[model samples]
Target: MTSPSFNPYHEWLGIDPSISAPDHYQLIGVPRDEQNPETISRAADAAMSRVRQVRPGDKSQEWARVLDELREAKSCLTNQGR
Candidate 1:
């Protein structure tokens, strides 16, 4: 399905009929308030933790990517502190 909000393509969840004007939007997905960033970050942390638990042999680009995400998240919070 395409994004009902704007995109020429639908998003994973499906269309939301509540959004009347689809073309004006950039993309369609769950709203931030409904799917908060903190909630998403927690899910990401859990997945990364599981990977470390099962495979402690070494880290890979995937782990690095997760770390980068963590760094970015940290920056956001720290910047807010300023």
Candidate 2:
């Protein structure tokens, strides 16, 4: 039998599977109304680091995509003009 699939968003980030597409704030573990760039950056960095640490070696592509999503979230939340 094949092994079960891994969902980093749910398993690693604790995001609900129902949320197929979590927003930038949700992805970064910040309040939706948070307006501090430093907080947003720090949250994003921590999330990225966490993902990097627990990433499965066989799932490099999936982890890369997650990292990209984290980067995009950080950019969108921190820039405020993007």
Candidate 3:
């Protein structure tokens, strides 16, 4: 079963009445950390990647993130030049 932490989308749709959706998400219990920051970072990256992989998307939807990041970088560089 998916953990309660992953229920925002369903809850937002007014589906889970027995459990009141929190005004904000509460990440209780454990802190996410690793001896190597890259390890935890990679795990989060892979999990999000798997979610996207499971839901195949249109090209723009798929590439939107990388494109947006590049655009932001270009803007930052242009501002630095001025």
Candidate 4:
């Protein structure tokens, strides 16, 4: 079992969401001290690359899951109103 705050999405992105953050930016690798679009973009790109490596077959379900998480993180990070 995992803690409620243990987001596998963070793991997939090689980030730890539990890290101290002034806000939610750390969930996707952005620094709490500063919001950088470039940094968020890089994080999203890395997640995308990781999910893309999952070829179709036995891991199709995992691929779908990771892809969904990647999209979610990207949407939150890129949406200025968020």
Candidate 5:
């Protein structure tokens, strides 16, 4: 049985259990309190780096969705209102 915290989407996105959530910041593994563009960029890059290693296989669609979410997260967080 899967753990209560085990989410296939989060697993596919390479998001650690401790940082997993529906929000953009959590999706990118960046703290929501952080507002610096450079810091967010670095964190997004690191998070994407981990996610990019996933071989799509049967989950290609899901993988693509997560990648899109990461991109959106980066865009949103880098914007002023974040």
Candidate 6:
């Protein structure tokens, strides 16, 4: 029998699937109105580090996508204008 599917978001990041699409704040584990760049940066870095530990094996592409999302979240949250 095949193994059950793995969801990095839920299993690794503790993100709920019901979120469907998490905003930058949600993805980085920050408050929606968080304004401190340092806080955002720290949260993003921690999230990226955690995701990097996941050994997806055949799901390398999905792992890359999650990493990209974390990168984008950091960029968006740390942008002064955003």
Task: Specify the highest-TM-score model's number.
Answer: 6
What TM-score goes with each of the models?
Answer: 0.30, 0.84, 0.28, 0.54, 0.75, 0.85
Tens digits of lDDT, candidate 1, 43-78: 445444543453312334434544454445434433
* Strongest candidate by lDDT: 2
- Candidate 4: list runs displaced more than 4 Å: 1-34
- Residue pairs clashing in model 6 are none
Supply the global lDDT for candidate 4: 0.59
Q: How far is candidate 6 from the true structure (C-alpha RMSD, Å)?
A: 2.7
- CA RMSD of all predictions: 11.3, 2.5, 11.5, 5.5, 3.9, 2.7
Clashes in candidate 5: how many? 0
Total clashing pairs for each candidate: 5, 0, 0, 0, 0, 0
Off by over 4 Å in 6: 1-6
Error of 2 at 3 (Å): 7.3
Kindly report which residue pairs in candidate 2 clash with one another: none
lDDT for each candidate structure: 0.37, 0.85, 0.34, 0.59, 0.74, 0.83
lDDT tens string, model 4, 38-72? 77878777767875765546546655766766667
Tell me the tens digit of each residue's lDDT in model 5 across 13-80.
Answer: 55565664578877776777898999998888877777788776766766677778888888888987
Stretches of candidate 3 off by over 4 Å are 1-33, 56-82
Off by over 4 Å in 5: 1-6, 13-21
Residue 80 shift from truth in candidate 3, angstroms: 26
TM-score of candidate 2 on Cα atoms, chains taken together: 0.84
lDDT of residue 38 for candidate 6: 95
lDDT leaderboard ranking: 2, 6, 5, 4, 1, 3
lDDT string for model 2 (1-82, tens) is 2135556688668888777678899898999999999999999999999898883777777778889999999998899965
TM-score of 4: 0.54
lDDT tens digits, residues 1-82, model 3?
3344544323322324544432211111113322343443443344344334443234334344433433343333334425
